[model samples]
Target chain A: MKFVDIITTAIANSFRSKLRTGLTVIAIFIGAFTLTITSGIGTGVTSYINSQVSAIGAADVLTVSKAGDATATADDGPAPYDPDKATAISLGNGSRPGSTIQALTDADLGTIEATSGIVGVDPAVQVTPDYIEYDDSGKFELTVNAAATLTTADLAAGEQLDNESTTDQILLPTTYLDTLGFSTPESAIGETVTIGIADFAGTQQQVPATVVGVQNETILGAGAGLNQPLTDRLHAVELSGTPAGAPQSYATATARFDLDASDAEITAIKADLADQGYAAQTVADQIGSFETVINVIIGVLNAFAVIALIAAGFGIINTLLMSVQERTREIGLMKAMGMNGGRVYALFSTEAVFIGFLGSALGALVAVGVGSLVSNILATTVFENLPGLQVVQFAPSSIAIIIGVVMLIAFLAGTLPARAAARQNPIDALRYE
Target chain B: MTVPVLSAQNIGKSYGSGANRFDALKGVSVDIRAGESIAIVGKSGSGKSTLMHLLALLDDPDSGALLVEGTDAKKLKGKEVNRLRNQDFGFVFQQFFLTANASVLDNVVLPLKIAGVGPKERRARGMKALEQLELADKAKNKAMNLSGGQKQRAVIARALVNNPKVIFADEPTGNLDTTTGAVVEDILFSLNRDKGITLIIVTHDIDLAARCDRQIFIRDGLEDVTRSPEAIEKPAGAHA
Candidate 1:
């Protein structure tokens, strides 16, 4: 018979019992729906991670830290202190026990900068601000973390940190505005605040600074940026407070590499740093860990979808087998009318593919609709801090792959029944009551 | 002088295997010439239907050959046999065997569709066949909605829709009432006479068998062709 005729007949035969076929289609629908949603979730989160990586920092800049020599990895554990090895320097609240380390000195900084592919290196200057006050709202002590080369920040109000200025400009966190007695974030920007620290001989000293911006604190970036000259001024005051002959070192250094450097070149640079007893990592490398975690989660979700689909495949086989049994005489009639075995097989297989198409198309459409709604709600409410993020996103190629895989499964499932119909004996079938 | 449209030579067929086996036909032979109207009459289980099936190439005999339009049907592959069935022969059954859920027109259009006839031409030819069978007005009705005679006519239309060289009817009027059976017989005879197409029928009705141009009787897996063409086994109504 003609292909079109076979297809029409298959479709007609499939729906002969509407309820049975509809139920089978629904079984397939559940599988397709689950698969589409899970795939969309994978796409959305991976896309979110990509965006976050871009916003995190410049691609070529690597964070450089001195290599430790077999120190205790435990956070609360203690080990024998080696004055010779580099350690993380933690200066804490007064009278509180804090760890000090052999920081990267001028010599070590020069070594990192002189490494091949290293364009420049800047040592992170530690700042220990004693107190801050706005006009006579009593002085409150505060601590500071060294700023990353953060050019752009998600701001509540005001411009970004003035990295271009040598003058002492600061960006204060939202929590600080309340402590400094500022009425609003907008009002605090461009306002001058005084930072008081002890000068050389345990004497009270004060430095006036302009607040250039006010920003919401983020987990990745917990502190404020200080211009080069302000960093120097703070260090100068800190040095003056200490007695002469005190050793000076740094906690970490930031190194900028060639913008167009190849992966091998970057690897070579990292190797050189390692040889010099230092470690370096680029932004992509840092994000790689995060990607691995996300991928594991998506993988698990997709596995569930696969299991659901396999279960649905059994539904197809059952439905087609029942159809073949019910239509035994009709099958014989068609064969007697001259439908070849191949044509008989095609008819039944086409019915299966049609069922798959119904389920997959319905599932995909419903997924896109529902996934978009869920993503919007999440972006607005739960993931507000990470803006421009969709919690569920669909990719066309992934959608196509899902449909193709399901159809292939359906085809396999239909094989036994289609073969049964194809291999039916015409005389016996006609005689079948 | 008319050529034989189809012939069977020592055809043999059976069901089951070994001790449980039962032979339906054994060395049965028959010839159906073009434009001839005939009947193979026998009691139930007498292998009349088996002989017709072999003649139509619906089933192959284990030990004998079948020829259609002078082509050795035994030599044809399965695909070629199917093609031969669609293009050269048609069938009607005692049960009518109309798809209960399908419309009359769709039923009539089936063989043509299997023949791979295009939709327009298939429909036109199917309608023409239905009109010839006096079923045009009922074409849109479902097969189950029709009376026994109407259903048989729809089946006949289907058999003729492809304009086959030979039409095989296995008890075509067996289910209808006396008047309806007579009407179906009239249509079958006129089609054979006017269209010059070959007709081979299998039936237990001696009266119906007497109406054909030639009569045949099969007994115990073999055909008994009497010299006289007036009766199948004995003259009609002689036993009655």
Candidate 2:
């Protein structure tokens, strides 16, 4: 008969057995719902990671470090460098004088800035030293501090150090300022501080410096506990002039470049730095350990989601097969009247798909509600101290994929049952008790 | 003068193979004309139902040529036989065989649905068929809700929905009371008389067989035309 008549008849017949029909629909619904929730979670995680990566200029920044040396090497190789060992060497307690393989020099930064795709370059220099600071109570306390130079571009507020100036002016990150009882960035600026500097010869010199700027510290540094906001542990200090002593121990040189460089262009820049006896790494390589951890977490979550979806599919099949058995006689009557095997198959399949659609729609609604509730609970309970962990959001692509997957599962569930119904012999079916 | 609505020649049907084979029909030949009501009357296990099935094209017979309205049934494939059943033959079973879950209208329109008619036309034809059976008022009521008599009438309406040339009733009134059986018989005869349709009924009811224009008697898998008088005679004190 006409498609409309066949579909209407099939739907009408299904409802004739309300409990069976409802169960089948529920099966499809579960399948669709699980798929939507899992995919939505995946989308949320991906989006969150992407945003965090963007905040760190992950898409544009690349890092280069010394590869293989007891301490620092110019070559880009794998070596676990320990700052404690460098400190021991500086204290002359180690037999092997730490090697001074400068990875990136001013010349390397200049060369990188001159590269065709390169827009700007800044050399980063860092050294961590133990400083005894007298607090307001006049008690001398040994505090571990990282002395580094950061550019104006990297600073979230205030200004960078003057490249040609001999003045002892430096920028303090907000974390360090917070620990020092400074309420705001403006208050932290112009605060004079004294640091004890020691040379490899074991001679110490006291230097007075004024905070010319304040900046918000990067999450990487914060998460590493290097810049404890409550402890005011790390400080960014600019060297006024070169010290007359043996070569410095544990130096870090960082360079910033243009954002739009392609992979090939980045590789060329790395090669030029290597030619100058320097090691190079991309931003992704710098965060390789973090990325691995994130991937493992996402992969495990997705696997669980897949298992749930499979279970849902089984549920659908069971429901649909039961439905076919219950409606066997009705199917036979339709076939006898003029409904070809194909029409009968389509009718059953269409019902299955509709069930799937309904289930998925319900699932999506449930996911949104559950996701919102979970996110709110997480934000209020576990993530209260953390910023930017409000609600999990999914992309439109995720929505489409979830719906498509649910529909596919539903179709598969209905297919075999429909075929069984279609293959039934009319005479045998009519004779069925 | 016109072609016979159904003709069967030397039709033989057997179950199983080789030893222990049981033959349901033995080279029986019959022709049923248009506008005539005929009955095949026999006791249980006789070949009457088998002959009716062969006439309705619901089953194939070995070593026989059967034709309906000049179309060779023997040459038709499985699908073609089903098409013939759809377009040329209507069947009424003893158990009513109405789709119990569906409404009377849906049960009647079942044949038209199988024919792939559009909804509007299927409904109109189903309604017309129900009207003819005086079941129009019960159109929306489920078949199971109908009385034994009304259920049979609904089944008859379903059979007539396709307007087939031949109506095959295999013990159509077997499950009904005597009053309902007589009413069903009247409806069948009226259909044959008014619409010029062929009616072939298989029953053990001799009175029912006697009401038809002609009666065929089947005994031990063979037609016994000499026993036609016995087919006509009702049992002593038997209720009609």
Candidate 3:
């Protein structure tokens, strides 16, 4: 028979027993729906985290520090502290508690910069500012870190930090706008703010900087950011009263390599750093741990969805088997009319594929609708503090892939029954009661 | 002098294997010409149906050659055989195996559909066949809704739709009443007479067999030469 005719006939035959076909479709629907939803969740969370990480614009940068020796337990009477390793730096957020490596000094920064793959190194300068005061507001305690040269902060208003500019510049967080006596982020731009810092001898000094920008809050970035000039000015003022013998060291530092380097190349660079008694972590490595956990959860969910699909596949087999049984005489008649065995198999298999198409298309379409609705509702309620998060998101390609996979499963499930129908002896089938 | 449309030469077919094997058609041979109505008449299990199936190319013979249009069927590939059957033959069974949920027209156009005829032409040809059977008005009705006689007429329409060189009827009127059976028998003979289509009917009724131009008696899986066409004709009314 013509392929078109076989398809139409198979579609018609599938609906002959509507209840059975409908039940089978419902089973497949459950699988497709769950699969789509879980895949959407994976896409949603990953994209959100990716957006946050990209906004920080530190993809190629790696934080490097002197690798600390594995410390002794509390019962070991605390290993003798070396004065050279006085400072400890915490790797934030995803790292385990007390996962502190030793500080990076000027010598360590020079060593990192001298490494073959390292293009630049920025030592994390410790700037302790006592307070930041505006025109009329009282002084407020401040936490400040110099903005990395490579980072393009997620800004609320004004331009980025001008690291090359001679004048000191500061980028305030959005939370400081009202407290800094500015009605809006834009109004704070180009205005001067005083940062008070205490020297090592307890003498207080004030440094002035122009507010160049206001940045939005992000999970990875905390406190205000200072440009190079501002950090240099603050460091110079605080050092004026420092005791001559006081040792100086940086808590942490960032090392930059070629952005387009391959993963193996990047690993080699890290190994090189490790050989120099330093440990390095790329930005992806820092955020990747969280993503890994999320992926494991999503992978588990996907496994359940696959199990459901396998069950649905069995339902398709059962449905087609019964259909073949009920239509034995019709099959015999068709065969007698010169419809070949291949055509007979195509007829039955097309019915199965059609069923799969209906269930998956409906399931994916409904999932997109329902998932979007739930995402919108959750975004407004549960995830209100997270501005750019969508709890469930769909990619068109992923949806198409899901439907295709389900259809493949259905076609495989159908082969058993289709082969049975095709292999039937026409004369015996005609005589079938 | 014309080549017979179908010629079976000592074709043998058996069922089962080893000790349980039973010969359904043992060295049965026959030739059917175009435009002739021939009957293979026998009682149940007399191998009449087996002979029809082999002649129709629905099953392969265990031995010997079955020829269609003088070409040895054994030499043809499975696909070629299917094409030959689809294009050159039609079938009607007593069971009236119309798809119950499908329209009568759908059932009639099945052969044309199998032959990959386009929808419009298939419909036109199907309607013409149904008109010949006087079932044009019932074309849209589902097969299950048709009466017994109407169903058999629909089956006849299906057989005629393909415009085959030969029609194989397996007890075509066995399920119909005498009045309807006679109507169906008249249609089959008329097609043979007017269209020059070969007719091969398998039946047990001597009265039905007598209506054919010739009769072949099958007994014990082989042709029964003792009961000739003259004997079959003479006893046509006695069996009724």
Candidate 4:
């Protein structure tokens, strides 16, 4: 018989016992649905993390701090503090309480910039702006970060803060737009605003800067971003009355290295810096723990999906074996009519594969439909703060792979019953009551 | 004068072994020519069905040669045997063995499908076979809805679809009423006479055996050679 005919006939026969076939299909559907949903969640989360990592800073930039003493441990009693190294700083996300690295100073920044493979070093200067105000609008408290100069903003409107511009520029957060008397992000672009800050003498000083852009809220948190020129003005105003003999200290420093450097090259740079009592971490290092947690969660979910699929595989075997038993006389008749053993085997195997196709196709369609709906609802309610996260996203290639894998499992399970049917004695089967 | 269409030479077949060994057919030989209607008559367990299976190439003989045309049946490959059966032999069983869920037309076209005939061609041939059996109007009906007589006729339609050189009927009329049985018997004989298609019937009914051109009486796994020639020479339609 023709191969096409065998497949078409097998597909028709699968629906002969509607209840039995539908139950088996539902079993497979459970596995496929879980697999597709978990896979989408994994894709959605990892892609969002990746975008956040890129937003933090350029890949080549490394956060550098003073390394702890070689022999110091948490169990050790507090030691006498030296004046030059008493300052402390905290690394964000996944850091333990009381985990602080000694702060860097101007002398340390110069040393890092002069080191081999180090191109640029920008000190992490702290700036506190009391409030910002537009024409006739009341002042609103605003948080400004000088580190924003080393980072890129996820913009909602206008361009990114221009680090190279000699003129003072600021990237405003979307939350402050309405309070600043701007109706929209686009309307605030290129408009000037006054930032009030108290100097060391307790006198308030007002600095005027033009808005460069407006940025959307991200998972990392959103704040006003000050470019190098605007940050220098704020720093100068905040330290006007401080003593001249006091040493300048910083929370941390951003150092740039070769963009195309190999892992070994970067590691070697870290080792050199360690010898000079400094420590360095890349963006991936700061975000690596988060990725690990997400991966572990996804792996556990996938394990459950695999278990469900294996159980469904046994369901396919049971269903086909029963079908073979019920159709013994029909099998004998076909064999007697010149259908060969191989064709008989093909017919049953095709039936099993058809069942897999039905369940997986239905499951994937419903998953994409429901998953998108859930993501949409969550985006506006629970995940409202995260603007660009889809929460669940489907990749076409992964969906295809899931379907192919389920079909393969069905084929393996079918081999036993198909072989039994193929090897049946025509005379005996014909005599079967 | 012409070569016999099927020849069996000292064929033997047995079932079981050791304590339960039973020889279904010890030594049976017969020759059937093209266009001849022959019956092998016996009681149940007399090996008439076993001998028919050997001649039909469905089972292998333990000893001696069974030949189709001129080639020994044992010499043909498995696929060749299947092809020969598909193209050259048709079967009608007392059980009717139709897929009840399938339409009557689908049941009738089974042999043509196994032969890999195109859909349009098989449909036309299948419909023609049904028309010949006077079942053209029931082609769309489910096989389960057919009466015993109509079911037997549908089986005949399936048998005729492939236009085989021979038709094997094993108790074809055993499940039908007397009137319908007569009608089925007439159709088998007329096909042998008009189309020159050979007929091999296995039946225990004496009246049906007498309708054939010749009868081979099998008793105790062997042919009864002592049967009188006059019994074998009885004319068709001589019995009710």
Candidate 5:
């Protein structure tokens, strides 16, 4: 018999029993759709993490942090700083000095740049203080830690802070404008801000500064008020007439290098930092705790999606079994008409696969819409607490994987039923009432 | 020397096993020649249907040899049996086993489709068969919508679609009224006369059996070929 005739007949027979066919299609659709959406979300989360990691620069970045001394580890809790050691090392007022504290310095940065396979290195200085206030309204004070001066090229908008300026000027992050309820970045520029610096005696003294420009904020770091709104944290104070006896607080000197830098070069940089008696840690080590939390969230979501997909598979089995029962005589007739077992199996499997394909397509579309809506809603409400973080992104690989999985599941679900139909004895089937 | 269209030897069939086993056919043998119309008259449970099934290759008989058009029926398997049934024998059941969902034309083309004829050829042969049965006008009508006599004619057209050498009618007119049965009987006889196709019919209708060229009486799975005076006298009285 012609293959066209068999296919056409199968399709026609399926249609002849419209309710059954519709229900079967729906079962497959639900399965495929669930897979598509879940996979889409998974893809979105992974891609979001990757982009954040990429912004930090390089996939192979491995960070190391200092391990505490025996006594501190035994204590396993926060400890008071050693004032005598802090004064000896000139590490602010009451900072503790430990054997593993390896600070990075300019010399260490230079050594890293000169190492084999090393590229450009950027050395940085960091300070932590609560020195942010607004002249317009004295209602709130912004408390922050860590500060850095970045070039205008790194900013999503506005000009960079001038290194040679005698005046106390600074650039704010875009997220700061959002926090201050300013409608746009331009409006936040040139704003006067009075920063309160805590002296050694723990008294607040005010320093006036002007906002020179505004920079865009990154999503991952936006919520924590870290890099964004740096104007308050990184105060551009007049240093020409400053007292020489002023204490150097807890400071960070960071180095940026090309992604292709070898592990040997990185190790050399670390060793050089240790030789300089400065403590250093990589960015990955600092964010390790955060990544673990994000991974757990992704895993939980995937598990739920997998359960739904399994349920959908059961639905397929039920629908296909029903179809087999209804088409018993038709199948027998086909067998009698010389349709081989393989051909019959292929026909039923094809129907199942087609159902899955359509369902997955529909599901992916729904996931995209849902992801966008949920992301936007969360950004406006729950995510409002965080300043510049993006939680979701459109991911194509995830969608493709979802489609592939749905097709595979649907094909597999149809196999047993199709085989059962094929294995039926033609004589018994013909005799079946 | 006319060729024997069908030959069966020592055909026996039984149901169940051991003590409960009951033989339906006990070593029955028969030969049917080309263009010969033979009626096998039997009471119920006489094994006539079993013999038809065996001859049609729809079922295999135990400890027997059966041949149709010189090909051994015992040797054929699976699709080969289907091919033999399609290419050599046409079967008409008392129930008129036309696909109720299909139109008359589709019903006729069913056997040709089974034989793997191309669509155009299948349709052409189907239409020709319908024309032969004078059911061409009802070609597009569903078999379910037809009268009992019309349905039988449609089934006959389906049976003849592949141009088989022999046609088997197992009480083809059993479900019809006397007037409709007469019409069906006339069509069957005309096919045998005009197409020279051998016909074998199993029936309990004495009037129907009288129309055939030859009749064999079956009782308790055994054939009595001896012409009884009563059987000869009945046909003569019907003619008078």
Candidate 6:
């Protein structure tokens, strides 16, 4: 028989027993549905982590901090250091490292810059920008949330703050336009705004800077950009007038290396720096643990989904065997009419594949719909504290892979029954009651 | 004489071995000519149906040579055998083996489809054969919906759809009443007479045997023609 005719006949015969085939399809649906959702969770979380890590800085830049004598747990935020008393520094994420880390002396700075492969070094000083005003507006408290030099940020208006420019320039976030009485990001361009922060002696100090651009923030993280001039101004005011804290030191140190350096050379430089009692990390190193944790969770979830798919494969075997038994006489009649054994085998196998397709396509489509809806709701509720976090994500390639896997399982399940149908003796089948 | 359309010589087959052993056909042989209507009448378990199956190439004999249109059928390849069964032979069984779920048109189209005929031509030939059997109008009806005579006619249409050279009916009317059986027999005989198609019937009914041009009898797995002196005088070694 022609392949087309075999396919048509197989399709016609699948409906010969609808209820049994439907039950088998349902089993596969449960498996595919669970698999798609679990993969979505993996995609969504890891994608969010990627955005967070990117927000930290470019690949060639590392945050360096002083390593301390005392061992610190992984959760230790940052080591507190006092210049007057001796203290060891184990600087980590967002921290600068050294023992009793004092202000980086000119001598220390020269030594850091002289390190091989060290192209540049910028000291980071954390300062709280407490209050702000535009022109003659009333003073409104604001948070200068993680203002840093961003390598990649989508802009709403104007150009990026030039990091090489000596002018004190800050980039305004998209949300601040309405709050600061600016009708639009375009209107806020090149406008001067005053920022208030506490001086070293605990006095309210107001500093003015120009807004060079406006930035679009994502759901996970957003930040303002500050060039060297602006960051230096904030640090100077923060250190002046004898603030309550005893001495001066940097919160973190940003180091630049050749972006084209090989991974091995970069690793060597980091090891040398670590030997100097300093911890150094690229953005990926900071977030590598996050990737591991999410992947493990996704792996466990997928195990359950695989188990469901295995169960569904058994259902396929049971369904096809019953179909073969019920069609015994019909099979005999077809063979007598000159249908070959191979064609008979193909006919049954096609039925199995068709069932697999029905279940997987339906399950994947429904999973996308349901998973997206749930993730959207969580975006506003459960994940309200974290911006740009998609709890569940779906990819087209993942969907294709899921369907392919399910079909493979179904094909394997059908083999035994299809062979049995092909090998049936026509005379005996005809005589079967 | 023209070469017999089908010839089986000294055909033999056995069942289970050891104490349960039994010969189904021991040296059974027959030659059937084109357009000839013949019968192998016998009591139950007398090897009548076994010989028919061997002749139809549905089963292989333990030891024998079978020929079709003078070709040594035993030497034909598997594909060639299937092609001959699809194109040159048709069968009608006592139970009228039509798929109960399929429509009459679909049932009749089965043989031609298996022969690899295209859909349009299979349907056209299937419809024409049903019309000849006076069952064309009921083509869309289910097989189980037809009465005994109508069901037999549908089965006949299915067998004829491929325009086979020979029709083998094994107790074709066994399950029907006398009047229905007579109608079925008339259709089979007319097909042989008008189309010049060979007819081979296997039955226990002497009256049905009387309608054929010649009848062969089988007793204890061997040929016996006590009722036909002409058959007894025929040369089994004519080709050999």
Predicted candidate 4 versus true structure: per-residue lDDT over A1-433, tens digit per residue: 8887888889989999889999999999999999999999999999988776676667898888888877677788777777666477765323487686777778899899988989899887778889999995799888775457756778889988887899899998888888889999999999999999999898999999999899887666457989888888899999999988777777678889999999998898888888898988887777887789999999999999989989999999999999999999889888888889999999999999999888888888898999999998998999987888889999999999999999999888889999989988777787788
- Which DockQ value does candidate 3 get? 0.70
DockQ of 4: 0.67
Question: Per-model i-RMS in Å?
Answer: 1.0, 2.5, 1.1, 0.8, 3.2, 1.0
**Taking the tens digit of each residue's C-alpha lDDT, what string does model 1 give over B150-176?**
999999899888888788999998899
User: What's the distance in Å from true for residue A147, model 2?
Assistant: 15
Residues B146-214 of candidate 3 have per-residue lDDT tens digits of: 999999999989988878899999999999999999998999999999999989999998888988999
True contacts kept of 3: 0.73
Candidate 1 local lDDT, residue B12: 92
lDDT of 5 by residue, A111-160 (tens): 55564433455433333445466645443445332232322223544555
Task: Answer with 5 or 6, whichever has the higher lDDT.
Answer: 6
Candidate 2's residue-wise lDDT over B15-113, tens digit each?
778898989899888889988999898888888887887787656788688887788887777677668778777878887777777689988887777
Give me the runs in candidate 6 sitting further than 4 Å from their true place. A40-57, A65-116, A135-142, A145-147, A154-159, A172-189, A213-225, A241-252, A270-279, A285-289, A372-394, B17-22, B70-74, B224-240
Model 4 chain A is weakest, by summed lDDT over 10 consecutive residues, at A86-95
The alpha-carbon lDDT assigned to residue B20 of candidate 2 equals 82
**Per-residue alpha-carbon lDDT of model 1 for A125-228, expressed as tens digits?**
77777888898889887566454334456577887666667768777877788778888999998888888877667676788888888766544555555656
lDDT of 3: 0.88
lDDT tens digits, residues B71-137, model 4? 9988899999999888898989888899999999999999888778888998999999999999999
Give the winner by DockQ: 4 or 5: 4
Candidate 4 residue B61 Cα shift, in angstroms, is: 2.5
Q: Relative to the unseen true structure, what is the C-alpha lDDT of residue B64 in candidate 3, on a scale of 0 to 100?
A: 87
> A307-391, model 2: which lDDT tens digit per residue?
7666766766777788788767666655554456887788888777666666677777777778778877887887664445544
lDDT of 5 at B134: 86
Candidate 6 on A1-433: residue-level lDDT in tens? Answer: 8888888888888787889988999999999999999999988987876765565567788777665445456788655664543333333333344324534433445556677988998766655677778886767765553445645555679877776798888887787788888999999999998888887678888888898888766443354566667877887887777646554455457788999988998898799878876678877776776678878989999999999999999999999999999989888888877778988999999988888888999999999999999999998998875656789999999999999999999889999899999998777787788
**Model 3 C-alpha lDDT per residue in residues A1-433, reported as the tens digit of each score:** 7778888888998999999999999999999999999999999999988776665566678888787665567677878867665577665433588786666767778889999888999876668799999984799988764443446777889988988999898988888988888999899999999999987777998888898999876555567888888888888888887677776777678888999999999999999999888889987787778799999999999999999999999999999999999999989888877788989999999999999988999999999999999999998998876777898999999999999999999999999999999999889999898
Off by over 4 Å in 3: A55-60, A71-84, A87-99, A110-120, A126-135, A138-150, A175-185, A193-197, A201-208, A235-240, A257-265, A287-290, B236-239
Please provide, for model 6 over B110-140, each residue's C-alpha lDDT reduced to its tens digit, 9 standing for 90 to 100.
Answer: 9987877899999899999999999999999
DockQ of each two-chain model? 0.73, 0.41, 0.70, 0.67, 0.30, 0.58
| 10 residues in a row with least lDDT, candidate 5 chain A | A144-153
Q: For candidate 2, what is the lDDT? A: 0.67
lDDT for B64 in candidate 4 is: 85
